[model samples]
Target: MLRVENLVRRFGGITATDNLSLDVARGELHAIIGPNGAGKTTLISQLTGQLLPNSGAIRFAGREITTMPSYKRSALGLARSFQITSLLTDFTALDNVALAVQAHDGHSFYFWGSARNEKHLREAARSALARVGLGHRADVVVSELSHGEQRELELAVALATKPQLLLLDEPMAGLGITESARMVKLLQELRQEVTIVLVEHDMDAVFALADRITVLVYGRVIASGAPSAIRQNEEVRRAYLGDQHAVTDHA
Candidate 1:
């Protein structure tokens, strides 16, 4: 569903994404894992069009979107959920998602006075919230929700667009064990519905959820294959996993 070819991006003398290339198949969950400074976020930024590659190409479902603006990408069924929570803390969870629906489908947040009050937008928002297990918390102010709920709300916001491929940047970044487990289960279910490209540090989550894992080092792919193969890869263990052998223990 997504293909990146010879992708390169640099900052002054530093190369962030060096001839990076990878592909995500339809209906499969592909995970990108690497240590800090490995360029995972840079790759995602370029894929989402937030940061254009210095050179190379990105194609989604057969359409070239390398330089397409992020909003245009969204229109083409690409959506991203960031590592950090991107929610309107003052609004109810339902309101936040409803605005996404309005922006994606209605093309304007103000097409109707308040998105949550528009029956169509409201119903869609409700469905997204329910999918992310946030239905009962819909009316709660984002600021008042727990950190875990906020993270779930972010997923709901992304789902509101009905994306074909969901790019999640560390959805479990701040969660505790219990919350993380809940997220893992939620993703297991979500993967059945949408193609997912995940960038996360949580090895247990990555190994548990990934259909394929790509290891990156200094902006290049060090290894890419099934979880078992990645675990036995000497270089992957040497560079990133580094006794981070939770890799072998996850499944």
Candidate 2:
């Protein structure tokens, strides 16, 4: 569903994304794994239009979107959840999701005084919340939710847009063991609904959920294949996996 070809993005002398390229097939959970400074996040930023590439091409669902604005990319069925939580702290979880729904529907934020009063918006928001297991906490303010709950809420916010491709940047960033397990389960279920591109530091979760793994080093793909193959890749191990990551049943 997504294709990146020889993409390059440089911050002066530092090339964050150096001729990076990859493809994500429809309905697959493609995981991007690498050590720190490997440019995974930079690549995602380019995909979402938060940063423009110095050169190369990006295509989504067959169309060129390398230069499309972030909002335009979102409108074309692409949604992203940040590495850090992005939410309206003072608002209710339902309100935050409803706002996402409102925005995706092309309803100007100023059109209605609030998204809460709109029945359609509320219903959509509720559905998104339920998908991410946040329905019961819909009325709770974002600031009051637990860290895991906040992460779940962020997923709900993205899902509220009805995206076809979900770009997740380290969804398990700060979660504990149990919370990380829950997120792995959630992503397992979600992958059935939408194509996902996951950038995660949690090797366990990555091995558990990724249909295919792509390993990056110095902003370039060193290895890209099935989980089983990736685990045995010497180059991948030398570059990033090191001696820490253990073999999972996936191999």
Candidate 3:
């Protein structure tokens, strides 16, 4: 459903993404793993139109979206959750998601009515919250939410867009063990409904959830295969997974 071909992004003397190429089939959970500075976030930025590539192409479904603006990309059924929480601190969780639903519906100008009073937008937002297991917290202020709840809220906000492809950037980051497990479960559930491109540092979660894994080192893809193959790849072992293994063993 998504295709990236020979994508490159450079900043002066440094290359962030170097000729990276990959495809994500419909309903597949594709994970990208790499050491720090491997250009994972850069690749995402290019794909989501937050950063235009210096060269190469990105196609979603069938059409090329390399130069499409970020809002246009979002309108075309692509959604992303950032590594950092991007919720509005003062807004209620439901209000934040309702605004997202309203934005997609092209009705952002409606200012007077409580966004919560718009039944369709409210229902849509509530459903998104329920999907992320946050229905009960819908009325709570984002600032009052725990870190894990905030992460879930991020996913809920993304889902409010009804995206066909979900780009997740380290959904498990900054969570406690139980919270991480909860996120893994939520992501596993989401896989049944949408295609995912996961950029994660949690190897166990990646191995458990990814239908396929791509390994990146120094802004280049060094390996791409199934979980088992990725686990055994020498280059991956030498670059990232070896460190992952050591951490796992010590833990």
Candidate 4:
């Protein structure tokens, strides 16, 4: 569970997040949707301790983590998958996840043995890959992976930490229809195991995966509710979903 209260962040004269307040319940999937420049990423940065808020508070699992360092936050069960793929091009997918597992297991400083040779680390890494449906591609180099596989790898790395809350930023950004559907299925399966705070432009995925949705515009929360409630909200229609509806009708 996480709680963000009256969070505000600014860049020079611009306000990126304006007193944003929200909560993610234990084991719930919460999605934040907004147009470009809506400050969704900024809010995530603050929550993950990548950026300090101008004011307000962030609490995770009952402790105030607003001022904790990023690595410390990760150690405390907060893991994130970035919007862009962050992987080692030369490393095998298994090696990449193994490093994550090593980091989580407090053995990352060991350099004598190949991470692959450490059975405990390898098993942990393989389990994470299995969770993301990437077990078969463990030995493949990241450069050889398709875009969708890379995305799944990102999720696997995050899962290697055994996070209580997973913060995902646009996991479907560049996927084809089938790939997106695959991602949806994987996320749905993951929902039963971890709390998720998803930030995505894919409305279908958001609707299908999110237990609740929060709409952000101009760096402020415009709406927050269940899928059905968000669909029927007049403010949400005028501020965000109107264009989506028009596109859907034409399609």
Error of 2 at 147 (Å): 0.6
What does candidate 4's lDDT look like per residue over 92-162, in tens digits?
A: 99999999988887775558356878899999999999989999999999999999999999999999998
lDDT, candidate 3, at 113:
52
lDDT (Cα, tens digit) per residue for candidate 3, span 134-159: 99999999999999999999999999
Off by over 4 Å in 1: 244-250
- Residues 1-251, candidate 1: write the lDDT tens digits: 99999999999999999999999999999999999999999999999999999999999999999999999999899999998888899989999999999999845654545785689999999999999899999999999999999999999999999899999999999899999999999999999999999999998899899999999999999999989889889999999887767345455
Segments in model 3 whose C-alpha atoms lie over 4 Å from true places = 110-114, 243-251
Q: Residue 111 in candidate 1 has what lDDT?
A: 50
lDDT ranking of the models = 2, 1, 4, 3
Backbone Cα, N, C clashes tallied per candidate: 0, 0, 0, 0
Superposed by TM-score, candidate 2 places the C-alpha of residue 96 at a distance from the truth, in angstroms, of 0.5
lDDT of 1: 0.92
lDDT of each: 0.92, 0.93, 0.90, 0.92
Query: Under the 3 Å rule for N, CA and C atoms, how many clashes does model 4 have?
Result: 0
Question: Residue 226 deviation, candidate 2, in Å?
Answer: 0.5
Top model by TM-score, which number? 2
For all predictions, the C-alpha RMSD in Å is: 1.4, 1.3, 2.6, 2.4
Q: Is candidate 2 or candidate 4 better by lDDT?
A: 2
Across residues 70-105, which tens digit of lDDT does each residue of candidate 2 receive?
999999999999999989999999999999999999
| Segments of candidate 4 deviating more than 4 angstroms | 110-113, 243-251
